[model samples]
Target: MKAKKTTPQGNKEITDLILDSIADGVFTIDQGMRITTFNKAAEQITGYARREVVGQFCHDIFKADICFKMCPLKHTARTFESIVNMEVNILNRQNQEVPISISTSILKNRKGEVVGAVETFRDLSLIHELRKEISRQYTFQDIVSKSKAVAKLLNILPDVAQSDATVLIRGESGTGKELFATAIHNTSLRKKGPFVAVNCGALPETLLESELFGYKKGAFTDAKRDKPGRFKMAAGGTLFLDEIGDLSKGTQVKLLRVLEQREYEPLGSTSTEKADVRIVAASHQDLSSLVKKGEFREDLFYRLNVMKLEIPPLRDRKEDLPLLVDHFVRKFTEKTGKRIRAVSKRAMKRLLDYDYPGNVRELENVLEHAFVLCKGPEIKTSHLPENLTPSNHRTAPQATGKTSRLPELEKQVIVEALERYGWDRSQAARELGMHRSTLWRKMQRHGIEVP
Candidate 1:
């Protein structure tokens, strides 16, 4: 610099500095396809030093016989001026293929004659990491519920994580039963194993059976190939069966056998395979009463009810509403790339006062809708659904005075408690000065939601 050096060394230094500053890897290849320039990022990406890569054939560096096999490189080079974007797998020093997105442009001399090509590529590893992190941070635990009932459930989670016991989760729809199931699976010793879930009520009895137990090839009209059932796929893992109360009697018998024998035979297959899965069944229906009514199997009910966990509804967990709102605000902000900061107090009070029949799921949906509709940073009553807004009109209870019996009153109280605390039964039971299990029993006897 003191002598204002004009040698090739000065030009090469400037080029290296420019390439090193770029986040993406950069490489240059001459007309003969030999790598002439390899940037620092390129070295990091390929796990090869610049000295080792320079002067090597570009195809050899990428472990490809020809770079233009599926690429537009040849066309771009012939045209002498064009930019192309493509997804390609490039081999590293260890010969492992890594996915990358490459952007290539032709390099030309000062007289406009094509000389070589410059390619910039970004590694896909960072994208995969960001996706995984986003998924982990959004599910279940992020759902806030401050009711002591929910806290108790959270406290027991660690214990549940240590066991492979069959768990039955009873709750109303939208009470976060699936979230509890996922949390238990993720926290358990079998976290690395598959976590398969099915909604029993969503499918027909025939489809549900086949879905759970899988079928051998030619087992049915559409069974072209043998399929691994959820039970088989979830081996050494956890299977979450939602709406278990809706399972038909025949399916119940099969499930009971799987539970008792720890093995099942696929449809149209003679050989029996052992199942190494932990069952976590949930329902929004009263299974005990259904059993007594001869609708559900008593033996199966007893087997599943061994370690029962009840999730409280949103109304029962009113204290957690604010926390949930805040969490959702941040979540939707990042999701939509909006700047939403808070929910209005008056709107929040209305939300707390309302009886959320749909439970936590409904609350989340409400927030999501509000986030989309809100015009400012703060969410307000105007952003909420019409049905949730306070109105002068009221609907009479379906039950008449003649039907206002003890069971009816109990059911009403339980439902109201569920609504008040956002469906948190533990807090509701504490408010009633009775044990959670006792409350569950009463709810069952009164025919209230207790899946």
Candidate 2:
């Protein structure tokens, strides 16, 4: 054989350069599962040199969560199919758990025979950290939920809290509109200042105005001396206006001035006082509808809608029911001095099946009722309120058996897939045509128990 000088411009060298240039870890293994090629990224991410890792079995080089049962690369090689973004945790040389998303495909020779498998994995440590931070940051006070809808709201809530914009929390009655307003205030820059709350619907027109903007001496027959109103009480903080939709037309005009000019006059006072308080208004009714009906002031509606956080009703976030139930159980357990630790399977199923018209508030009340009845470590069906009972037609739970029907079918699919694939989640997910993470979430959501 004649020796010839070859440049790095060759296709093989160019391909190697491209692979090394990328950040994702890339490695190829032979049919015997021995590493054939290890890129620079693979070496960096795994803390293994190319010379050290090459020729070593992948399972030996990188210990992964699925190494024992559901190896994605092995599945890819056996099926000759590519797997994309299978999330798994692996231990690096430092023995620290590193989250990663693996994408794998079988390598074929020129004869179209499967010779080996190639895998590309990206480190998800930063992403996992961000997700954890989001969970910690968005949760304020006792507002806890695992539903993506709530999570999405919370993800942006920190930004909303940091600003001085007026916030309007709209949701169904008992959907915790006021709670959200409180959370906004508690998380805001004015957290150190006082938070004054008032129910606009609770007071009549004459009393409402006087209550909001305090009356001066002899302003009314009962007025004896000058008094500070909610605005004054919440100076440099937040004033939570509950049920602002019920505000009278006259009051709305005054509120508009306070929003526009950032100033308002006290009852019977000619001079205006600068309003330093931030407004966080809440209403179950639609202010936009009120505007269309010529009831709520158009300008006032815009002012209030500057920063709207419309919370989803309880029926929409049923996935969070279990978490809410747990929270309530813990709360009542502490208050009543009971050792209640769990809700029975039947009781939990019933709770999940119910359409919570009153939202999270109603769930709390139901748990309180259950706590009063339950004297054991667990909450059973008997401990549940009569309204939560299946016989109670007013609040039917699983009458049509369609409440958790989707999840039930989904569970069946996962179980069947697992059985068919001999308990290989990687192969099952591939057969089901879903990302491994998506399958995992679905499994968790459906509460599928493996054999």
User: What's the lDDT for all of these models?
Assistant: 0.79, 0.83
* Candidate 2 lDDT score at position 372: 85
Residue-wise C-alpha lDDT for candidate 1, range 305-396, written one tens digit per residue: 97889888777767777677777778889999888888788889777766665566667778888887998988899998765733112224
Which ten residues in a row are the worst by lDDT in model 2?
387-396
List runs of model 1 lying over 4 Å from the truth: 1-140, 390-451
Model 1 CA RMSD to the hidden true structure, in angstroms = 15.4
Reference-based lDDT, residue 143, model 2: 84
Task: Go through the candidates in order and give the clash count of each.
Answer: 22, 0
Residue pairs in candidate 2 whose N, alpha carbon or C atoms collide under 3 angstroms: none
